[model samples]
Target chain A: MNRQVLLFYPLLGMILLGLFIGGLAYGAVPIPLDHVVDILLGKGSDKIAWQNIVLQSRLPQAITALLAGASLATSGLLLQTLFRNPLAGPSILGISDGANLGVAAIMLYFGGTLGQFADWPISGYMAVILAAFAGACAILGLIIYFSAKVKNNVMLLIIGIMIGYLASSVISILNYYSSTDRVHAFVMWGLGNFSGVSLEQLPFLGSCTLAGLLLAILLIKPLNALLLGEMYAANLGIHIKRTRILILLCTGILTATTTAFCGPISFIGLAVPHIARLMLGSSNHKMLVPVTVLTGSCIALLCNMLMVVPGSNMILPLNAVTPMLGAPVIIYVIVNRKNIQYFN
Target chain B: MAMKQTSVIKTSDLSIGYTLKGGRKKCVHDALNLSLYPGEVTCLLGLNGAGKSTLLRTLCGFQPPLGGKIELMGKPLSSYSQGSFSRMVGVVLTEKTNAGGITVYELASLGRHPYTGFFGQLRQEDHRIIEESLIAAGIAHKAHNYVSELSDGERQKAMIAKALAQQCPIILLDEPTAFLDVTSRIETMVLLHKLAVEQQKAILLSTHDLDLAIQLGDCLWLQEKGRPMACGTPEDLILGGAFETFFSKEGIVFDPGTGKLHTEAPTVPVGVEGDLTTSYWVGNALIRNGFKPSLVSEEYVSVCCNAPNDLRILFPVGDMRIAESIAEMVSIIVHKS
Candidate 1:
C-alpha cells in the first residue's frame, strides 16, 4: 500500500473514535466525556440518571451507528460494483424500502397489537425486526431468482426497481387504510433512527452485520476481478454466477439488518465507498473494503453526533442529517465523475 | 513434425453459435476442424457478424459450443475446471478494461487469480512471473503508473501484459487491433508474433487488418457466415483460392499474384514494363484508372527506367508524355486516353 492507502485506516479510526465519544457525551442530556468513560468502565457516574443514559441508552445507540454505518457502506460498495453503476446504493434495490414496507405493515396494518400478534411467534419490536428482515429478504430472493434468468446487470437493476415499486405500493395501501394515530406511528418509523436498537437487540444486529462484512471480505478477490467487466472476470476464473449471487446475498443481509433496526438509513452506503475511493486514490477492494468500513463508521458516528441539536432539547432525525453530508459528496462525485479514476 | 506433435489446442468437428429459446440451436458454423500449434500465431479473419467473437468466447470457455469438442493440451475443454482452464488459456477481450484506479502492476496481478489464494495474495513466484510478463509485453516502464494514465497503445500493451501474466501456454485475443491506430496495430501484431515465438506459446487472434494478418500470421482461419471455416497457411490458402472465395464481393477480388486484395476488373487492358519498383506503382495507377496492366496486352503503357526526373510515360497512341510523379503520370494517362 502507498502512503495514502496506509494512512486512511488510522485517520478514519481516530475520527470515528472522536465522533463516537461526541455521540456518547453530547446527547439531549449533557454528559461529560470523562463521566461517559467512567460509566463505560463500570465506575459510578455520580448520578443514576446519567448512568441510565450512558450505560443503557447512548452506548447502544453509538454502537448501532458504528455497525449500521459500516454495514450500509459495505452494501453500497458491493451494489455499485455488482451493477457496475456508480450511483447504486443499499436502498436502490428497494431492500431497505422492503424493510420500510414491512414496518408499515406492522405499524399501519397490525397497529402493533401485541395480543393480535400474540398468536404468532414474536411480539412488539421483535415482530417489526422480523417483518423487516422477511420483507427485505423476500425482495432479495426475488432479485436472485430473476438474476438467474436475466443475464444483464442493468436489466436486473430495473427488476430490482420494479420490485421496490411493488413493495412501496403495498406500503402505501397499508398507510392509506390505517387510523390517524397508526399512520403517525408508521411515518415516525419512516423518518429513520439509529437509537432504535436496544441493549438487548445489539447482539443480533451485530452478528448479522459481522457475517455480512466477513462475507464481503471473502468476496474481495472476485470483486477485484469484476473491475475488469464480466467476460474478462470469467476469463480470470472467477465464477461470475456464484459470485453474483453471493454478492447479492451479502448486500441483502447487511441492508436488511440495518434497515430493520435503523429505518432505511440513507447515503452512507452509497457515498461512503466513493469517499473511501477519493481518499485512497484506488479502487482495488483489498484496501478499499477496509477503508470503506472505517470511513462509514466515522461518517455514521459524525452524523449521529450531529443529530443532537446544540443547547436545545430538540434532536434532529437521523435521515435529516445524513443527506446534508451525503448529498453534497454525491453531487461533487457526480460532477467530477469523469476525472475520478474509479468511474473510468 | 514438432508442430503436429505439439498442438496446443485442437478442435474436432466443432460447431459454435447461440442456443435460442426452446432448445433451438442457431448454429453459425459446423463441422470445423482446427489446430493451433505452439510457437505460431493464427489470425482469424472474417466479415462482420461472422461469429468471430462467438467462436472466441466458445474457445475461452465463456460459453459452451453448440456441438463438437475442444481439446486444450489433449484434454477435453469440458474436463478442465475453470481454474485449470484459466491456467492454460489466457484471454484478452475486445472491450476496454475498466480497471482505471488500479496500477498496471495491479491489473497484471489480476491475471494470477487462478494461482493466488482466496484473498489473491500474490506469492513471490507470482510476482516474479508478473514482472517478467510485463517486461515481455514491453510495458515494464509503466508498471507503477495507473492504467488510466497510459496511452491507448500503452493501455493495450498493459492488457496484453495482463494476459501474459496468466502464464498460460495458449493466449487468445478477440479483435486485439480493432481499437488501435495503424502504428499501434502493427506494434501489437508484432508483439503477439514475438510472444508466440519467444514464449513458445500458441497464440490465436481475430482481426480485420488483413494486410497485417497476412504478413504476420503463421496460419489463417477464414470464417464466413454460416460456412465451415477455412484454415491453412496464408500462402497455401491464397494458392488454393480460399482467400479469393472468402473475400469475393462486388467490385473487389483477391489478387494471388501480389497476395493482396485489389478492386474490380478493369474495362481496358494495357501492357506495362519497367523495373519492379516503377512497374508496380505504374500498374497500381492503371488499375485505379479502370485499365488492366499486364506485359501481354494489345494496348501498351511503359515507364522509362533510366529517367531520374521528368519520368516518361509511353501511351498506346504512340505519344510519349513527360511526368514528374505517379500522380501526374496517372493524370496524363487519363487526359491522353
Candidate 2:
C-alpha cells in the first residue's frame, strides 16, 4: 500500500470514532459533551434520566448505526464487484426487498402476530425478525439456483429484480386488505429507524454483522481478481460459480440482519461503497473493503446524529436524513464517471 | 515445415462446437488432426464463423470438445484440474475486461495465483519474475499505470506481460491484435514471435491479419466453411496451392507472387521497354491501371522509360507523349486508351 492509502485507514477510523461520540452526545436531550464522557467512563450523572438516556438509548443506537452502516456498505461493495456493475448494491438483488415483503406480510396479513399460524406463540419484534430472515433467505435461494443455471450476470440481475417485483406485488395486495392500525405500523417500519434496537439486542446484532464482515475480509483476494471480470478471474485460477454464490449469501445475510433490526435503512448500502472508492481512488479490495467498512460507520453515525440535530425531541427518520448526504455523491459519480477511474 | 519432435497439444478427429440443451449438436469443424509444437508460432486464420475462436477455447479447456481426444503434454486435457491446467496454459482473450482500478503490477501479479498462497501474497522471487515478464513484454515502464489509463496497444502488452508472468509453457490468444492499429499490430505480432522463439513456448493465436501471419507465423491453420481444415508451414501452404483455393472469391484473387489480395480488373494491352528498374515500375503501373504488358504492335500502345524521371508513350496511331513521372505517363495512356 502507498502512504496515502495507509493514512486513509486511521483518518477514517478517527472520523468514525468522532461521529460515534457525536451520536451519543447530540440528541433530543442535548447532553453536554463532558457529561457524555463521564457517563461513558461509568461516572453517574447527577440527573438519573440523562444517564439512562445516554447509556441505554444513545449508546446502543450509535453502535447499531455503526454496525449496520458497515454491513450495508460492505454488502454494496461485494455486489458491485461481483456483478461488475457500479449500480449494484445490497438492495439491487431484491434480497432486502424480500425482507421488506416479509415484514409487510407479518404486520399486514398476520396482524403483527404469529400465534394463529403455529402452535408456539410468537408476536411483535421477534416474529417480524424471523419472518424477514426467512423471506430474505427464500429470495436468496432462488437467485442462487438461477445463478447456477444462467452463466450471464446481467440475466441473473434481471431475474432478481423480477423476483423482487413479484414479492412487491404480494406485499401490495396484503397492505390493501389490512386494517388502518396495522397499515400505520407497517408504514412506520418502512420509514426506518436506527434506534429500534435496544441495549439488549445489540449483542446478537453485532456478532452476526461482524461475522459477515469477516467473511467479506476473507474474500479480498478473490474480489480483487473479480474486478478484472469473471473470465480473467477464472483464468487466474478462481472458481467463478462458487465465488458468485458466496457473495450472494454474504450480501443476503448482512441485508437481512440489518433490515430486520433497523427497518431496511435506505441509501447506505448503495452509496457508501462509492464514497469509499472515490476517497481511496483505488478499487483493490485489500484497502477498499476496510476503508468502506470505516466510511460506512462514519456516514451512518453522522446521519444518526443529524436525526435529532434540531433538538425538538421529534427525531427525523434515518431514511429521511440518509438521502440528503448520499444522493449528491451518487449524482456526482454518475456525472463524472469518465473523470473518475471505475471500470476500464 | 518440419515440426519439433515433441508436441505440446495433439488433437485427433476433434469435433468442436456448442451442444444445445436438447442434445442437438452444432458442429463447426470435425474430423480434424493437428499438433502444436514448442518454439513455434501457430496462427489460426479463417473467415468469420469458421470456428477459430471455438478451437482456441477448446484447446484451453474453457469448453469441452464435442468428440475425439485432446492431449496436452501427453496427458488428456480433461484429466488436469483447473489449478494444474492454469499452470500449463495462459490465455489472453479478445474480450475487453474492465481492469481500470488495478495498476499494471497488481494485474500482472494475479498470474502467480497458482503458485501463491491463500492470500496471494507475492514473495521476493515472484516480484522478480513479474518484473522480468514486464520487460519481456516491453511494458515495464507502465508497471504502475492503471490498465484503463493505458492505450489499446499498451493494455494489450500489459495483458501479455501478465500471461508471461504465469510462466506457462503454452500461451493462447484470441485475436490479440484485433483492436490494434497497423504499427501496434505488427509490434504485437513481433513480440509474440520473439517470445515463442526465445522462450521456446508454444504460442498459438487467432487473427485476421493475413500478411503478418504469412510473414511471421511458423505454422498456419486455415479453416473455411465446408473444406477440411488445412495445416502447414506458411511457405508450404502458398506453394502447395492451398492459398489459391482457400481464399478465392468472385473478383478477388490471392496473388502467390506478392501474397496479397488483388482485384481482377479489366486489362488493356501495352508494351514496356527500357531501364530495368523504371521499366518494372512502369509495368506495375500498367497492371494497376488495368493495362497488361505485351510485345509492342501497331494496333496497341507501348511505353518506354529511358531515364528515371522521363517516360515516353508510343501509340499505334503514331502519337507520342513525354512525361516527367509515372503518374503523368499513366494518366496520358489512360486518357488516350
| True contacts recovered per prediction | 0.72, 0.53
Q: On a 0 to 1 TM-score scale, where does candidate 1 land against the true structure?
A: 0.94
Give the lDDT of residue A109 in candidate 2: 81
lDDT of 1 by residue, B1-337 (tens): 3336568889998999898989999988888798999899999999888888888989999889988889989989999998898899989887655688999999999999999998999999999999998999999999998888887888889888999999899999989898789999999999999999998989999999999998999999999986678988898999999988998888678877666677766767666665667767777777878877766433666656333345677766677778878788778767766
CA RMSD per model (angstroms): 2.7, 3.4
Clashing pairs in 1: none
lDDT of 1 at A173: 89
Runs in model 1 deviating more than 4 A are A1-3, A113-127, A141-162, B1-3, B296-298, B305-310
In terms of lDDT, the poorest run of 10 residues in model 2 chain A is A113-122
lDDT (10s digit) by residue, model 2, range B1-337: 3435688999999999998989999998898798999899999999899899899989988789999999999999989988888889998988656578778998888888778887778899999999999999999999988777888888889999989999999999999999899999999999999999999989999999999999999999999877898999999999998988888868877767557666874457898889988988887777788887666677898888898688888888898889899999988988886
